[model samples]
Target: MSTPDPDPDCPSTPTTTGTETYLSGGCHCGANTYQLTLPAQPSPPFPLVDFDHCTSCRRTSGALLQAWIILPQSWAVFHISSTFDQSHTVYASSVVTAGALRKELGGGEPKSLVHYASSPGVSRAFCARCGTHLVYSRVYEEREAGDGPEGEGDGEDFVGVSLASLDKDSLERAPRPLQHTWWGDGVPWLKEMIAKGCEEGGIGAMEKLEGYQ
Candidate 1:
């Protein structure tokens, strides 16, 4: 079957339980740093961290596997690392929804960011200096044909970032992922890694999808 058309305005249900906590994280060089405000208990339709095996994610990160921490833009907090000083460059998109709320973007790219336009409308931001994978995001371009942003994202989609960038405090608090995607393009080594994760006490037990483990 052909892939379905992507709904730019994917529905999003923001139900912060009022027990949210803050988690801090940065890159290996400390040049890229940010914070994530996560709910104490994860709401439905989203988990703390999810693994992606799509060819894009794998190729961009130079590995067979990559993971993303899903959090709404309203809930995901950005910060500035002292090391960047005053040279952080902003990588903004044509998406008008995020224009006014650019302040809420993850981390202050004061010193300029290395932005990779992974696809036509999808963008992946990373640290220009330390080369840290930051956010995997898509623009919800408001088109005249849509019905007031009622799709899966609801106009305020979560900024996808590397789960490894989240602080340990957040990691401990993160719930185990229950599902994954993009298996139509199967791989060999990743399956081995998944089986190893099951044996070595990683994110496993997600056998609902065959051939992943």
Candidate 2:
């Protein structure tokens, strides 16, 4: 069966927008740098934002909450460099698909980028030099309901970037996470804090320790 046409208004498709904005970011040690092209006011969540509470995400990131932004791989341009510095060159200039980008990077261009299989068919990328968690990806299989063939399924590759990896300006420009994922895997207190914070008005609901103000 053929794949369905992509939705033009979907947040995943940045090319549908009239105006474009670029967000530049990289790992802490600058080993991996990328620029994400987004719509001026990208849909509701052009760069789809969310908080991942999965145990794997928490353990890999070593953070209480792991924030991520999802987008099509075609929207991102990666900069590869032998030296992690301001001067880096773009390796793959053409638009790359989600699966293609993973393969290209996995070939070891920068030599600092490393990939780990967090679970079967689930991969996570990080900077070996800086130890900064960078990306999480998963392969999803969709089997159309029909009597075509046994175990026949189409695979979709998705990529999610670490929100904290974005530059200061990009982080400020990015939208706030709209939802929580893997809530069951989250710490109880952290979940309560989020619930209460939403119930009240923002961070004001949380306890402000000494020198916090």
Candidate 3:
């Protein structure tokens, strides 16, 4: 899929109408700087959500489940020019699955997201500098129009970034609904949160992790 052109009309400064708010953050070294605009009311405290059974996420985070959030690519405005200079690395665990989908269904290769290999074509991306887990993109076999190659293919273009790793104030700005993923691979401890009906993207878990990190 073609990337939307940087809106020439896109404002240099993001707009805030009280409905939407903007947040800024970067890696520990400040190399991978970025800004995102999201709804401000119920801010997402924890950026990490469970990718329950995703193998790649397990390997990358060294945890049973991978947690992430989907943000509009437009919300992500980066200062660095290239991911390479910023110390980006790519994993090819699931490239074959991605490649196959592109060939048969015509979905383009994954974009600037990070990659981690659980197996071929089954990689996940995270911030190289600070280890902030990002999005999980893979190639699945099903190819129904508008779902796979033809349509957005489960919203592949939607980029997921780790909320735990972002700057604190920024995390408080653009709150989002927590989303559960790959439940089959989820760890047992997460069930406690589910029992309490914890919201998906809330920062409760992230704060606890910060004490250890």
Candidate 4:
């Protein structure tokens, strides 16, 4: 599938409240959902988004180009389902090391989100029902458990949320993506499509929007 222009209705508007910012997103089938929070700052990077033109992303997501939002694992919380109504515990260490986690939610697995090992240490998560690519995660440490550092993964675990899965309101309120990655792998028409999308359906009009100006 080709990466078509973003819907004009989702104008990339990004929202803010006292001392914090938030963006809501999910899959096409409402099977995967999440809320991303950005701590208050002098200037908020509400949408630290990236457009990925990598072959892996394109083939897996079936889109011409994949747009992803970069977030630190510790900086965001995720909930599954159409509505953000579920709960779980995060184990920076092993859940077994902590008592509260065992009783707080289901077994210690990424709920409902099926993951595929896209590479040796990279996992690509997607919705089992709708096939919407949710998040791409990469492991930082590869040594066997108890053999490497105290933790199974290095502190550098990363998360990349699919930007196209965001809600219309969140999309409209979101900041423009930071930049395009793997642009060289994209088709020759990719740049023209982006420019056209910006002019017609993307964040090009955002600067003129109220408050943003």
- Weakest lDDT window of 10 consecutive positions for candidate 4: 93-102
* Candidate ordering by lDDT (highest first): 2, 4, 1, 3
TM-score of 3: 0.50
Alpha-carbon error at 166 in model 4, in Å?
0.9
C-alpha-based local distance difference test score of model 4: 0.58
TM-score comparison, 1 vs 2, better candidate: 2
Q: Which stretches of candidate 4 lie over 4 Å from their true place?
A: 1-15, 42-47, 81-111, 142-154, 192-213
- Sort every candidate by TM-score, greatest first: 2, 1, 4, 3
Each model's C-alpha lDDT? 0.55, 0.64, 0.45, 0.58
TM-score for each predicted model, relative to the true structure: 0.64, 0.69, 0.50, 0.62
Residue-by-residue lDDT tens digits, candidate 4, 60-105: 9998889887655554455443222223221121211111211222
**Candidate 2 lDDT, tens digit per residue, 88-186?**
322332334445656756674455567798777677888766778988766554323442112322333446879898877778877688888889999
Decide which is better by TM-score, 2 or 3.
2
**Per-residue error at 102 for model 4, in Å?**
16
lDDT of 3 by residue, 1-213 (tens): 222222222222444776866655544443344556666553333232333445555667666555455443444554431333333332221212222222322334433334465555444555444555543444444323443112234433334555554566555554544555566666556655664454554335334554655
Question: Number of clashes in model 1?
Answer: 20
Cα RMSD, each candidate? 11.8, 10.1, 10.4, 10.8
Measured by lDDT, the strongest candidate is 2
Candidate 2: give the clashing pairs: none
Question: Cα deviation of 90 in candidate 3 (Å)?
Answer: 21
